[model samples]
Target: MSAEFLAELATLTDPAGILTGAATDGYLLDQRRRFAGRALAVARPRDTAEVAAMLALCHRHRVAVVPQGGNTSLCGGATPDSSGQALLLSLERFHGIDDIDADNNTITVAAGATLASVQAAARSAGRLFPADWAAAASCQIGGALATNAGGINVLRYGNMRNLVLGLEVVLADGTIWNGLRGLRKDNTGYDLKQLFVGSEGTLGIITRAVLRLYPAPTAHATALVPVAGPQAALELLHELQAAAGDRITSFELISAPCMALLAQHFPALPQPFAPIPDWLVLIELADAGEDSALQDKLAEVLFAQGLDEALLAQHASQSRAFWELRESIPEAQRLEGVSIKHDISVPLSAIPDFIEQCGRALLAAYPTAQIIAFGHLGDGNLHYNIFLPDHSAGVYAEEEHINAIIYREVAERRGSFSAEHGIGQLKRGLMQHYRSPVELALMRQIKQALDPHNLMNPGKFLPD
Candidate 1:
């Protein structure tokens, strides 16, 4: 039966489309190299028709299908199970931009197109695709939309979910749903495209998307300010918003540990701070006029608030240097070695309390733990990670206990355990613990209604 399935799958696309044995090894391993699995074969479908045909064949054969885009999922969302009975579907072949409507300010692209590619296409057309992050160069549109990814710009443009106007998806049973409408206002009925936006490929495979774009910003201003603490950071955020309005695009919070990590691992990178302040806020503003005016407006606000130590960018290179410090943090952490990471969000007002209380609790439990807390404070999401005495995978033995302390604090503050990152296999178990019964029930019912056979990305997003 396995041989028969592979033979049939090869017929759906060219011989190069099917990968088996060691050729499928690369696709099996995840981004962080934490999770690895086995697959009967890796299927590279060239277009929506091929994807639909492959899914139809799998449906008939009762074979499991795990959809993967770019293989950059941080939570092992795209990895196949260990059973070796599943077919891994790679969307790499479905590349390129379909269309870019400058008048409508929208770009239609194949799901496999990298976020960077889409951004370039939009820029060439004199528009902006605001969904961005460190992984923009390699992370594909389908995975970004599937996870509803959030980035620094999320404070202004919102998440990938907000940028998407419509989607073209291939359902579990190989039915193509063409709902790629580019209208800004559509109040006809339930928005079906949303179901697949953050579904993590459990309900269907996102083949294409019509994403909303924005006017390119003509002016940009960036600055890095040392704050007393999270409370000071919060106060500064509001003050800047009041002065700059929606032009304030990013407001990132960086802990002292992050600066130390950068200094230790990325020594060549500019460390503008002296003696490493306990906290720092990197603020950016973008608008339609000249950058000098925007820069002056930002400087006036900071000086008025008595933030004399703020380092404002004088040119484009200086601005890039400020952002590089923020963007290079994850790599610095990776170089530092293994650590238990959490992507969480709470009410903006509760951030200061959450950081203080959560840090205190974690320290009490593990005295040697080095807490590295930082992220998009403007959007209430923080990539709070902890490094233990044992800088190895063995540290994961304490992950559950550590997560309990932090998640409990988040729960108490009405925050979320999973923020921008989707609940892939890594956090699926937490769903039962953190989510209410009714909410879980609704998700299960939706999964049942859509992929009744449970063949679509089996053992992910939803719990057993």
Candidate 2:
């Protein structure tokens, strides 16, 4: 990067506009610390105008820009490459809730606004912005939409892509595309906003979004049910969904290893059941009415299905406690050690077979490996992670093998290699192998159309 360019970039905003040296350290490192890269400078623009000006300068100079949000990407999506050539464009300053249209059931917020903040804003208005994840407090709205993040509530409210009604994006050429319409029934022409939602910032920079909101649930019923295996778990899910219908907000599957890890790491947390079941399902129901018979419905379904082992949360505290266990699984896994993680999804009916077969194949190849399986069961997504006995030795030696086995099986079952987590740098290779030629070409064509110079998030989502 030239001094003249840096000087011009600095003039885009006030003091502290561009960061370097020690100041750039945090922006360069991702949440997972998997991809560390150098940046020409960390550009923190104050608002959309500054964002446009900075991006325009980068475009003029042909400098690659990586649009980063909270930098909470698991796949190192937000992290720049180690080439020291790309400009790290940070949206941290664009944190503002512009409007909350209760009548339209939509809230428009700046892209840098954290998910938790948006949720709080919705709650303040007696509405629910339901796209939630463990990193809600830190993950930004731009990152969420860019990755189309799917969380616990995905089965009910859908992913960030589904929740978005409109978007304000800054194109590669720094042209502002203000499609920030809050209307739900716009069918005039092409839905261009969809292009940037899950493009992982490669196509354009997501500056703002109009997100759909739902009526605040007045009551919640949560439960932890132990089952024999995935088959029994799926059967129970069928029974519950049959009984409770759309009231089922969350249905997560937890393997025994996950529960044990929780027990080991979080000793203070109560072990809900005696002799932790090898397979437990965390179920939750939510409704707008305070007098919802969710508990009674759950009990009836469990009893009728002969699922004898169950623990229903009797109060709000217990409900929160039950959810705390589900939320702690990822952190516990991180503390345990490095592992080959897969955020893949299969059909609801194929989950049992996929799990059993995949487990058998993985164990056959690497006998000492531990499969710490868990995820949103309601949506058929599984965090099918593998922890080797020697975590250090296996990640390098067997990661490819493990991913090959798992993803191949997923493909066989007509499943996706990258489910909730977008294909950033981590799964870009998989995108090449698994994605068909036509689909890949279409994606590349779109990337080429919007970002002809390939300056926006230079090397992510799309293949090299």
Q: Pick the candidate with the highest TM-score.
A: 1
Best-matching candidate per lDDT: 1
Q: lDDT tens digits, residues 1-464, model 1?
A: 99999888889999999999999999999998988999999999999999999999999999999999988898999999899999999999899799999999999999999999999999999999998899999999999999999999999999999999999999988999999999999999999999898899999999999999999999999999999999999999998889889999999999999999999999999999788999999999999999999999999999998999999999999999999999999999999999999999999999999999999999999999999999999999999999998678888999999999999999999899989989889999999988999999999999999999999998889888
| lDDT of model 1 at position 38 | 100
The list of candidate 1 runs beyond 4 A from truth reads none
lDDT for 350 in candidate 1 is 99
lDDT of 2 by residue, 281-324 (tens): 99989986663477788888887877777888889898889889
Candidate 2 regions exceeding 4 Å error are none
lDDT of predicted model 1? 0.95
The alpha-carbon lDDT assigned to residue 275 of candidate 2 equals 82
Considering only N, C-alpha and C atoms within 3 Å, which residue pairs clash in candidate 2?
Answer: none
CA-RMSD of model 1: 0.7
